[model samples]
Target: MHFVYMLECSDGTLYTGYTTDLDNRIKKHNEGKAAKYTKFRTPVKLKYQEKFTSKSDAIKREITIKKMSRQEKLMLINKG
Candidate 1:
């Protein structure tokens, strides 16, 4: 399975990305190795996730989520 996920950073910022291994991805973020943005913003927490059978679908969802305003993203997370 592929996943489109959002993370709440320690600084209260949000990040969205696609991954096939949610737990491992989050662990890499916490370890400052997953993303340059999340690297400096260590210790992020998983806020939301959506699963997809195909990687293309997950990537598309990730892009869509990344374009959302913070408030909109928060609403989505709340709904999830």
Candidate 2:
């Protein structure tokens, strides 16, 4: 399964991304190896996620989420 996920970094910032393995991806983020944004903001927490059947779909959703404002992202996470 593919996933579009949001993470809340230690600095209280948000990050959105697409992945196939949510657990491992978050592990990489916390380990400072996943994304440059999250690398510096280690110890991120999974704030939200949406599952998809295709990589394309997940990527699209990830882009959409990335475009959202901080308040909007927080709303989405709160909904989750």
Candidate 3:
């Protein structure tokens, strides 16, 4: 399964992305081996996630979440 996920960074910022391996992806972010944004914001915590059967769907969801304002994103995360 593909997954779209949000991370709450150590600095209180949010990061969004999609991955087939959720655990590994988060591990990479914490290890400073993922995206540049999260690399410096290490020790991120998984705040939310949605599962999709297709990679395209996961990517689309990631984009949609990325476009949301911080308040909107927080609302969504809280709902989850």
Candidate 4:
């Protein structure tokens, strides 16, 4: 399965991405080897995640989440 995931950073910012392994993905994010965004905003907590059968679907979800305003992102995360 692929995952569309959100992390709430220690700095109160949010990060979104698509991954095949949620556990390893979060580990990579905390280790500063995930996305460039999460690299600088380390030590994130997994706030939300959705599983999809296809990577394309997860990536599409990631793109939509990334385009959202902060408020909208927060709403999405909280809803998850």
Top candidate when judged by lDDT against the true structure: 3
How far is each candidate from the true structure, as Cα RMSD in Å? 0.5, 0.7, 0.5, 1.1
Error of 4 at 51 (Å): 0.5
**Backbone clash numbers for all candidates listed:** 0, 0, 0, 0
lDDT of each: 0.94, 0.92, 0.95, 0.89
Task: Give stretches of model 1 more than 4 Å off.
Answer: none
lDDT of candidate 4 at residue 31, scale 0 to 100: 94
What's the best-to-worst order under lDDT?
3, 1, 2, 4
Q: How many Å off is the CA of 52 in candidate 2? A: 0.3
Please give, for residues 18-54, the per-residue lDDT of candidate 2 as tens digits. Answer: 8899999999999999999988898899989999999
- Candidate 2 deviant stretches above 4 angstroms: none
Candidate 1's residue-wise lDDT over 3-62, tens digit each?
A: 999999999999999999999999999999999999998789999999999988888889
Better of 1 and 2 by lDDT: 1
Candidate 1: C-alpha RMSD to true structure equals 0.5
Off-target runs (Cα >4 Å) in candidate 4 are none
Query: TM-score of each candidate?
Result: 0.97, 0.96, 0.98, 0.91
Model 1 scores a C-alpha lDDT of 0.94
Q: List the residue pairs that clash in candidate 1.
A: none
